[model samples]
Target: MASPPCSAASNFDCGLEIKTRSVEQTLIPLVSQITTLINHKDRLKKTEKTLRAIQKVGQAVGVAVGRFVAVGEAIALENEELREEMGHACFEARRSGTAIAQLTDVCGVEQSAGVDRCTVFSDKMAMVKAARMLLSSVTKVLVLADRIVIKQITSSRSRVLVTLEQLERVSTFQEFVQIFSQFGNEMVEFAHLTGDRQNDLKDEKKRARMAAARAVLEKCTMMLLTASKTCLRHPDCESARINKDGVFQRMRLALEQVIEIVTDARPGAEPKALPISIYNGIQDFKARVEALRDCVYCVPCESLAVQLEALVEQTEDFTDSAYTSHEQRENVLQLCHATRQDTHNLVATFSQDQQSIKAREVSEAMELAILKTSHSVSELRRELHNVAVGRASELLKIHSDHAILQALKTAGEDGNLEKVADLARTLTEQREQLVETCRLLCHISGTEPLEITCIHAEETFHVIGPQIISAAQTFALHPNSKIARENLDVFCESWESQLGDMAVLLKEINDVFEGRRGDKRAYLSLPRPGKHSANLKTVKATKLDAEELSTIAKLGLELRLVTSDVDSELERWEDQNHDLARQCGSMARVVCSMALFTRGEGVLKTTLDLFHQAELLSEQGLQLCSLLQDFSTQLLDEERVLMVSEMEKLAVSCQQLQACAKTPVQGKSATFQKVDSCIQHTKGIMTVVASLLPLWHKLIRQCQSEHSSQASPQHWPDTQLSPPLKEDTLNGKGSNGFGVKSLEQHMASLTFLESK
Candidate 1:
């Protein structure tokens, strides 16, 4: 019960845990193959089949090990700090793979059936040694690659700090503008880097802590921009200075927290990881239970029983929760009972194996019990997945319509305190539902990252509910105050943003369950545009009204759905690693993040970041449109015209957005008009994307079908074509594609507005 004697097999004793799921799971098949190679004679009689079996598994192992080392070597080239160690590990892996190949040669034995039973079995020792070496090397490589990831994050954080200091010390508006632009670029880089790291981390609490730190930096960034400008405008004002100082302080603290998490720099800073769920407990229990075959005398069967009981107790989380459906509760109970029975049978077989005649039949019986227990555990996990995914889906739909927020807004504006109070109660009830759902989700999310997202959602709802109430009180008290309404709108958007985040997280969880997850780049790719931060002293962005925010939120939701649709089509491509898929997937992620950013509580922090994202999106869109234009006659001319026209609209809108972001306007009316124009432009861009996404997907599928099966694509049946021929430069692979001037037109995003 104390511990399983520092198990080299369990502890993984490599000084690192593989936090990435792909790296961890990659070892499973190799392990199984090795086990088969060493124990083949036990299962198969000596013959030509046995020789072929050895050849088959040996070649597979060598090739797998070789490819695994290649990945490690590539990582080494990227991270100089880990290069030597990673290179050494990769070398060892390749050497061991060669050793495995030689050990299982069996070529001379193939020609003769009776090459001495001793010769056939003699090299098993060397084979085991080579397999161990190969496995160890592969693990070392994975761990080293993981270290490189951490190093990249630490290096990114250092860059942000350097810019942070410059931004804090700048005295002139021009100096601040230049430094903040660099700072924005750095922060975006840091955001993208840390976001990937955050998702890759296996520790749920660490992910949550990282999320919290990043959230602080994101909001403080927007605050920092305004606070610094205010201080520069009123050099003698203490409040402005204090506000600027506070933003700087929070930014630094968030920066520190992020690094501390990745590096565990501070003593005692490592938080306890999330409590091990029933799924993990069952895995450990089964491992210990299975160990009885070899180490029956050394193992304590009592501990196995205790661990099973603990797993069963953990299931009480699902069974006892009021939110759980009766059927799910019953199913969980049944699985728990089945697992207990299977475990009991396995332990009984273990006892019989120890006391009886050490017969092959008894050994076989114990194996059967182990397999059944494992199956029971698998069933339990599936049921848990269903429960979690189902509950999450229901909660998402229930919380989808933000009618309560709209009602609260209207009531506040109307000075109806009773209506506002009633809506607040309804919101409170909704918050409780979300919080409980989060707790249930954490138990069955199946991965640390998702569990963290669930916890974040819960906390968002918990923190923002009271803020919404407080803001509503202020709005009702001063119905005429624009600031009060804005405050309330901010809280409402925060709630909506959490909903949007939860939707994405749900899809991710489902994707993991279905085994459709791609590489790390696809995990969080932005490839965002970096722009000069402008001094906007004379051009305060006119705040979006309720109608505008509503439109933005609706657009956000639509973009998210379309991006999901694009992801599905991308998955259907024959070549998973195709450049076109990667490019489109990157654009999809940017759009997805843009969707969340538009929803208001996302990582973009300010309108400036939003404008920057929009320009980058149009740039990607034009590139995509060009690619489409170059495609064969699969696309009809009119459809081509539509795609090209929409892209042009997106481009022009980005152009207008860039101008609005840069130029200073004199009147509030002028500022409002300019801001409205920007919004309308963004709407046009969103509309283009929403309509074009399906066409792009259809075209890709058509191209794919043509390549493999030579099937004609589904074409548009309409003959009434729109007029064409404004430009012929929309070719996908043309050197003379949409020129650099258009790129320049959008490069002045968030400009340093200097009055001439």
Candidate 2:
């Protein structure tokens, strides 16, 4: 091979063959590997996108599963239908979880491939299958959850509607309260379910739906409570007319039920020793008192007012347990005292109507009830204050100990001897202050001090101090080494754990103390023990004075005397007026007959004689009317004026009759008949005057009665008077003298003559 010498064409041909072999052996494979790597990179990107999508789907499924589980737990144990549905939802959620797990395993297996050349096509297929399965399961669970939620919503809505309808139809208080309580319970359940579901739901829309439902329930509860309060405060008086006893009984029952419902509906994880205002305890107490006050005036049945008062007292006693503040309790007690006094005054007023003994009995019962309620409130306030003071002191001691330990830890870590010493002194001072505070609280609350164990805090700080000294020495020996830092970090971590424990203990104490305090202010801020004396003095100052009582008695006596005098005068005037009117009528008739029979000068002389007699009678009537006016002016001035005017009209009519009769007949038959008609009309006027006399007498008597009954003289004239004379009297048969048979007969004679 070494000896081969070739020409230029042969050499070129050999070089070309070698180059072709090299291209076939190396470059083609290298290019093919680069193409494979690019394809694999693209497939990986696609797989990663598919994996992210699957993860999102899986997470959504997980959240759906959690929601379904919560829904299952929230469904009432007694509701078989909802429970079954919840079970189905939970099962679907579990199946979804299994599918998601299988999908995750597939993704892990696909990602386990070593080379980028192995595409994740199998993983993508698995991801799609898993996603489909998860979607199916999640969809089923969501549907079940929706169905359960819808069912619960429908049930709650129906219950609320029924309760509201029943509330509207309720005629009695008891029925209304029962329905209200039922409604409140349903709403509470609905809110609780919604809240639980909201907490579990990850979907914003579903959570929003739950929040909206809860808000609706809360609004409905508030409206119902407001309605109950309104009814209790100002009950319909017209409803009482239908069945008063039943209405009162029902009202009492309803109020009690409403209070119970409000108490139960209050938002607290646990029942408080003292009730919070959120329960509407104060409002309910006020409502109960107002109800008692209102019912006292128009109680439907005998003893109903008494029963209501007793119930109010009992309610006050119950509400007293809810009062933790001394000021509020004292205020309520004062209000109760005021109500009792007001009721007494009301009873006294009612007693003036000849019901003294009954009023006295009712007042005594109310007084007893109020006294008992006030006593209960006082006792409850005292107990609550004592409890609060004791609890606050204990909690403060715990927190102080925790703070002291924390200070000690920080000072020890800094390796500052002066600061450590100062912290030690502070810890000692804190201990002493805590002890003194506890003693003071115990003395104020009238209770024994509770024993507290703080061994852990002491031990933790005791070890930390020595550890800090060791760490400082180690740092001095090895400044650049991590050993000192590591040691200090370990100590710090251990101290942190101790501090965490102390914090937890303090937090527990705080929670307990705050819960005991409820809605009250700090116990130490309550009024001093002697504040009750001032309140008592204020209550006593409201009593009426002896001078006022004497004035009232004197006024009553004067009224009675005036009434007697007026009554006697009215009777005497009625008789005198009747006699005078009858005499005038007789005289007029005689004159009319004389004029009709006689003519010319003889008739004229007879009319003059009649006029003289009429003058005397008219003078007597005028004197009687003047006397009536004088008496009526004292009580009924307006009536007196009307009577006087009528008397003047009668006198005028009499004068006209006299003038007509005095005219000479002189062979004129028409003139004589006209004179007769004038006399008849005059008799009719006299008859009207006579009829009005009794009415005037009645009005005078009424004024006397009114003056006796009322206290103020200004109110006396406001008394209602008898109605005016009827149309028959003014313009009908009475005015025409047809009411009087004698007058009618006389007028008939005149009519006969006119006809002839």
Instruction: Give the candidate number with the greatest TM-score.
Output: 1
lDDT tens digits, residue span 547-662, model 2: 22221222222222222222222333433344333443444344333332221112334333534443443454455455555555664567767776776676566556555544
lDDT for model 1 comes to 0.63
RMSD of each: 19.7, 45.9
TM-score of each: 0.47, 0.20
Instruction: Predict model 2's lDDT versus the native.
Output: 0.39
Task: Provide the clash count, candidate 2.
Answer: 3
Model 1: CA > 4 A from native? 1-216, 219-254, 267-269, 290-298, 359-368, 514-756
Candidate 1 colliding pairs, count: 6
TM-score of 2: 0.20
lDDT scores in order: 0.63, 0.39
